[model samples]
Target: MLQDSFGRRFYYLRLSVTDVCNFRCSYCLPDGYQGKPDEAFLSASELEAAVRGFAQMGTQKIRLTGGEPGLRSDLPEIIYRLNRIDGINNIAVTTNGYKLPQRIQHWADAGLNHLNVSIDSLDSSTFHEITGHDRLAEVLEGLAKARELGLTVKVNAVLMKGVNDDLAAVLTWLKQTPVTLRFIEVMETSDQAVFFRQYHVRGDDIRQSLLSQGWQPVLRDVAAGPAQEFWHPDYAGRIGLIMPYSQDFCATCNRLRISSLGKLHLCLFAEQGIDIRPYLQTGVPTSELVQAVSEYVQGKKATHALQSHNSGAMANLSQIGG
Candidate 1:
């Protein structure tokens, strides 16, 4: 087993398949940002090899993330390769949910068991305003398609103060589906911090807003990630709040992220990551790669200063595997 500076075990890996996205969400990629990477990101084979090496190091959970993972054509093949690894216990993907309806069944067949869809608002006009795209109805349709394919679905809503603070509308819309909804507090990722001050919503504020609407917390004793979970007494599914800004979960963060260009990020707010593509290209032994990953993990920070410091110059969420 590998451990970080904060005594957090490394078991989960978030892999970014590409840095290209169809939508330019306000919080993620602000409007009119034209900076795109040079090459077509990692090929399916390169990503598969990386996952295999990480899995050999006791990383059992693999989450495919991206500017939008569905934008990649060979995503299923990458998932299939990861699923075939010996130690991989779970294979999941975090998408904008724009293309899920057409590919949900294909993804399920490729061994993807769980999905987290980013849906900031329930209103179509509000969603279009937030995402810079008019695919709100398509996202809802994708959520339904995931459920139909028997995939465990989670809705990730980045809670902003005046943007989509309508918890009532969000909850009401979620009640109509079986997807578990999670409200994410905005973080201080590089480009995000530019607009962070205006849209920042603390996790405590989110909990209070929901409580005011008669939502009760449901406690569970289970392994943890970035989300602090709760449940609505009357709703069919649970509510989770991932408060990376207000309350840090670095002490229990078991995951590491890999950028689309094959860099390993120890923390979300970290400025730089160790490049592993050289090791991959050289056909290094698995043990050597594991040792490299161990060294990177050992350098993980105890906590992020997103609330107190400025991290607006760091890599965007699309480039750094959200």
Candidate 2:
């Protein structure tokens, strides 16, 4: 198993297939995506090699992430190939739902089991203002289509002051929508300090309010991500809160990340990515790749220093597929 120095066993891997996103969310990519001419992202073959190595090291859950994973035309192929890997049991995708309604069927046919779509607001105008896109209706249709196909779907909303801070609509939606609604606390990045200060909201406040309203805390699975999920008997859906700023938040860290360039990120706020592309190249033994990754895992810190206002080398969430 991929065990860190702190004895945290990693069973999940967040793999970034691309860094280019179409959405210009106000908080992230506010100025829009700017990529250089030679953005050497990992190819499908390279991704398979890298994932195969992780699978050999006991990684079972793979979450395909990107600035917008939908932009990759070969996403279904990637999922299909990754599904054939020996130890991988589950494949999920985190997307902005840009072309999801059109492309979800292909992904579902390729063995996709879970999906996480970013929907900042239920209100169309507010959603357009936040995401710089007026495709809320299309995204919602995609969600319905995904549910129809029997894929476990989750919607994520970034909690921001004066913006999506009001969860009344979300709670109401959850009363009918049979999907998990995850509210993520806005995180501070190297370049997002000003925005973070002006909009960051406390996830704990929402947690307290939910508890008071009869939402029961659900025990986290060993391989689950950072979301603290809650369920209510009166509602058809569950609520999840991702509070990076909370104390002891990293105590149950069970996942690692790989950037689009085939670099390993020990933590989302890690100072730098460890390049593992060299071992992922053709002809390299899987054992050698696993050894290199295992050595790098030993360097993971016990916790991130986000509480002290240090986001390490993270300029934005897109860089590491947050």
Candidate 3:
């Protein structure tokens, strides 16, 4: 297993297939995705080789992320290849859900069993204002289809002050939808410090409200992310909170990240990503790739510095599919 100096063993890998996104969420890409066309993002073969290396080191869950992974035309093929890897038992994708209604079947057929979609608001007008896209109905339809196909679906909503923080409607929908809805705290990045300060909402307040309303905490699975899940007997769905600013949030860290350019990131706010693309090139031995990855994880830090408002090299969340 890949154990860091702090004794945290990693079993999950978040791999960014592309840095390009089509959505213009207020929190992430307020200015829109401004990047050169067809940048040198990871190819299907390169993604497979990277996963092979991680699997060799006991990584069992692989999450395909990006600015929006749905933008990748070969994403299904990438998922198919990762699913065939020996130690990888779970394959997931985190997307904006723009193309999910049309492409979900192909993804499901390609061995994807877990998915997390971004839906900022349940109100159409609010969703449009937050995401810069009028696709709330369309994305919700795709989510229904995903459930019908037996994939574990989760919805992520960023908790922002005076924005989509009102969760009454989302909770009402969850009573019937039977999917997990996770509310994420707006984190500070180097470039978005002002926005973060203005809109940040504390997740602990929401957790306290849920606890008072009879919601029961659920134990996390070994491969689960930072979301603290809760269930209520009156609702069919569960609630989760990703409080990155919470105290000791990284104590349970069990995942590493790889950027679209194949640089290893020990934490989302790490100072820099260590380039390991050379080891992932064609014909490189799996052992060589594994060695490069193991060495990087050995240097992983115990926690991030978001509490101090230091985002390090992470100017934007999309850089590593945060």
| lDDT to native, each model | 0.78, 0.93, 0.92
Error of 3 at 248 (Å): 0.9
**TM-scores for candidates 1 onward, in order:** 0.92, 0.99, 0.99
Ranking by lDDT: 2, 3, 1
The segments of candidate 1 whose C-alpha lies over 4 angstroms from its true place after superposition are 37-40, 209-224, 312-315
Q: lDDT per residue, candidate 1, 59-165, as tens digits?
A: 88889988788878788888898899998878999998876789888899999988999888888899899898898888888888888888888888888888887
Candidate 3 has its poorest 10 consecutive residues by lDDT at 292-301
State candidate 2's TM-score: 0.99
Residues 48-110, model 3: lDDT tens digits: 999988888889999999989888889999999999999999999999999689999999999
**Residue pairs with backbone atoms closer than 3 Å in model 2 (clashes):** none
The CA-based lDDT of model 1 is what?
0.78
Residue-level lDDT of model 2, residues 78-168, one tens digit each, is 9999999998988999999998899999999999999999999999999999999999999999999999999999999998999988888
Candidate 1, residue 290: the lDDT equals 81
Q: With candidate 2 superimposed using the best TM-score fit, by how many Å does residue 315's alpha carbon deviate from the native?
A: 0.5
